[model samples]
Structure formats: C-alpha cells, structure tokens
Target: MRFCMMESKGKRGVAASRDGGPWHVLFESEPGFPGTVDEIVRSGEGAFEEAMSAIEAGTAINPDDLKFLPPLTEAGKILCVGLNYKAHVQEGGMPMPTYPTVFARFNTGLIGHNQPLVRPTSSEQLDYESELAVIIGKKARHVSPERALECVVGYSIFNDGSIRDVQMRTPQWTIGKNFDGTGGFGPYLVTADELPPGCKGLRMVGRLNGEVVQETNLSDMIFDVATLISLLSEAMTLEPGDVIVTGTPSGVGISFKPPKLLKPGDMFEIEIERIGTLCNLVVDEK
Candidate 1:
C-alpha cells in the first residue's frame, strides 16, 4: 500500500492506493478517521486497516489539483546519515568511516514534491544529495542489527540539499542543513512489505536539469539500513513517524571541477528504484 498526504481546495486529506491503482482520498472531515499520515503511521497496523477502509469508501480526486505535503509533517526525529557510501566519502577526500556520520534536520527545512528549494541569499553553493528515507513505525531502543528492520514501516525519497559554504564553515553540519524549504521529501510512502528487505540492491539516481549527476546501488552503502538502525537505537529511542535519511552516493555538484551549484530555475530530481522520484525547482531567496 502507498499513502500520500495532500491538500486540495484548502482541505487536507490522506490518499491511499493499493498496487499503484487509482488514489482514494479521505478528507480530515471524515468521521472516525485519522486524517494525517503521521497519525496512521504512529498508530501502527490497526490504523492502516482503518485507513484502507476510509480510502475505499472515500472519493477519488483528480491529482492535478492536489498540493502534496511531506509524508509526515511532525516526525519526532529527523536524523540524517552522512558519508555512508564509500564513494561519497572518497569524493569529499575523507577517510573511510568506522561509524556512521550523523546529523539532524529540523522539520522547518522540509518541503514536498514539486515544491521549491529556496537557494539562500547567503551563498550559491547549494548542492543535492539523493538518498533513501526510512520511516520508523515502532518504538525501538537498543535494537540488534538482526531485528532492526522490524521497526520500519515504509520508505521514501529525500534530497539532502546542502549549503556547501555554510556546511564547510564549521565541523558541525546542523546549521548548513536546516535552511528553510531546502529538504525535499515525499510524493508517497510505500510500505515496507512492498519493498525488498532493507531496500537493498535498489538503484539511486540524481539528476540536475535532465542530466544524470549521481548514480549508485543502495547495496553499496558501507552501513546498510539495519546496521544504522541498530547503531542509532543504541543512543536514542526511535519513535513512530521518525525519519532516518540514509546517506547519498557520490557525484554531487560540489565534487565537480567547476562545481555545478544550483541556481534559480534549476530543477533537481532524485529517483530511487521501487520508490518514486522527488523533484524540486530552485528559487532565489527574496
């Protein structure tokens, strides 16, 4: 099952589809329904069954008129992994990491599909990092690697847009990654069962204005999903609706000789196999 959160005519709703069929939208006005994607995800399987019923009973809307929202608006945690891919680490001239490089992105930076990534007025070093987003469905603490995937509910795509200059300003990456409207997330959340275990062997491709810029097999990650989950859970509880952005592959603009940084009107797209493409247009900050 795939779930999408959207708004049309100023009303928020949840749209669901089975096997990529027509979308059935249930508005917030619906009785006895958890209207937001985060609600259903937090409630677990029971809520999914309830949502399925609501979706079937509700009307299907023309997608052309709906404005997409990030799959979860209120995720308790938005943890991001950096340099998980060997090539990505090599591109930045960093040594192979013995542990995952982690960072946090505030929700204020998130934007949905077809949204604009505001290029901050402070710099022109905006770069794109295409990655997979793991959505946690169950509470987990100190989980083992073997059972780590059991806590995931679904997967989505993410563009870990970075402000290069700011990111390199300090050793910490938080300030550079949390710029408003720079994180591109969503389009849909496809459940875990629909994908291979740990989403291994999938291909991730990133494009800038129709030209391929980054490409890699997800299996190439030095620290795969289960390992990252287990590692992260050891420190903090992974709650439902929490998002873990797996790290990106190499070929980012910053790695180019002249650096193909983003500018207004440039389109950045991230596509992962079995998931969907997340596209965003760039715009200069006013």
Candidate 2:
C-alpha cells in the first residue's frame, strides 16, 4: 500500500491508496479524523494497517483535490548518512570512513513534491544529493543487522540539497544542510511489503534538467538500511516515522570538474526503482 499525508481544504489528512489510484482520506485533521502523519506514525504499525483497511472500504478523492506535503511529522527524527557511497567519497576527495558519516536535518528544511527548493542568496553553490530514505515502523534498539529490517515500515526518496560552501565551512555539515525548504522528502511512502527486503538492488538516480547527474544501485550502499538502523539504535531508540536517509550517491555538482550548481528555473528529480520519482523546482530565496 502507498501511504501519503496530503493537505486538502487547508487541513492535513492521512490518505492511503494503491499505485495509480486516487487517494482515500482515511484520517483527516478536520473534525472527525485522526491527527497528523506524525501521530499515525507514532501510533505504530497497527495504525497503518487500520488506515489501509479503512481506505479499502471508503471512497477515494481525486489526486487533483489534494496538495502534496512532506510526509514527515514534527515529532519524527531526520537522521541522514553522508559519504556512504564509495564513488561519492572518492569524488568529494575524502577518505573512506569506517563509520557512516551521519548528519541531521530539521523538519523545517523539508518540502513536498512539485515545490521549489530555495537557493539562499548567500550561496550560489547549491547542490543536490539524491538519496533513499527509510521510515521506521517500530521501536528499535541494539538490534543485529539480520533483524534490523523488521523495524522499517516503508521507503521514500529524499533530495539532500546542500550549499557546498557552507557545508564545507566546518568539519560538521549540519549548518549547510539545514537551510529551510532544502530537503525534498515526499511524493509517496511506499510500504516495505511492496519492495524487496531492505530495498536493496534497486537503481537510484538523480536528474538535473533532464540530464542524469547521479546514478547508482541501492546495493552499493556502504551501510544498508539494516546496518544503519542497527548502528544508530545502539545508542538512540529508533522510533516509528524516524527517517534514516541512507546516503547520497556520487555525481554531486561539486564533484564535477568545475561544478554544476543549481540555479533558479532549474528542475531536479530523485528517482529509484520500485519507488516513484520525486521532482522539485529550484527557485531563488526571497
């Protein structure tokens, strides 16, 4: 089942649907439905199953009637892994770290499908990093890689847009990666049941204005979903809706001979096999 959180009539609602079908609002924030996506996610896997059941019995709304919104809720954590791809590490001229290069992204930085990624006036080196994001389904802690996948509920695409100058300004990459509206996180949340275990062996690509800039397979990740979830859960509890952006593959703008910086009027897309494409427009920050 494909689960999504959409906005209709100015209120957020939880909807479920099959691929190529209209969405059914199982829970809306209006008067009679459940709360936000965060609330449903926090409610655990049972909520997801129940919502799908309801959608099956209810009527679905036209896709045009709803506006896409970032599927993440404020209560959820956004943990991103950087340099997990060998080509990316080599292209960025960095050593292959034995550990996952982890980073953080706030909800404020996330935007939905078809939205504009803001390029701040302070930097012209805005770059794009196409990554696969896993959404946690249950509580996890100190689990082994073998059983790590049990906690994942679904998968989604993420554009880890960055401001290179600011990202490299310090040893830590948080500041540059946190600019508002830079994180493109939505379009759809494909359930785990619909894809191969750990979403491995899938081809993931990033296109800038119709040109393929980055491309790789999910199997190429230095640390797969199971590994990252197990590792991160060792010290911190991984709860439902907590998204782990596995890592972006190589071919980022800065990795080019000169650079391929994104500017206003440009379009970018993150596409992965099985999962759908997530496209966004680039616009100047006002």
Winning model by lDDT? 1
Predicted candidate 1 versus true structure: per-residue lDDT over 1-286, tens digit per residue: 8898888878888888888778888888876556699989988766776787778778887654689888888999999999999998999999999999999998889999998988998988898999999999999999999999999999999998999999999999999998988999988899999999889999989999999999999999999999999999999999999999999999999999999999999999999998989999999999
Off by over 4 Å in 1: none
Residue 115 in candidate 2, Cα distance off native in Å: 1.0
Clash numbers, per candidate: 0, 0
lDDT of 1: 0.91
Worst lDDT run of 10 residues, candidate 1, spans: 56-65
Quantify all predictions' global Cα lDDT against the true fold: 0.91, 0.86
Q: Estimate the TM-score of every prediction.
A: 0.97, 0.94
RMSD of 2: 1.7
- Superposition error at 253 for model 2 (Å): 1.0
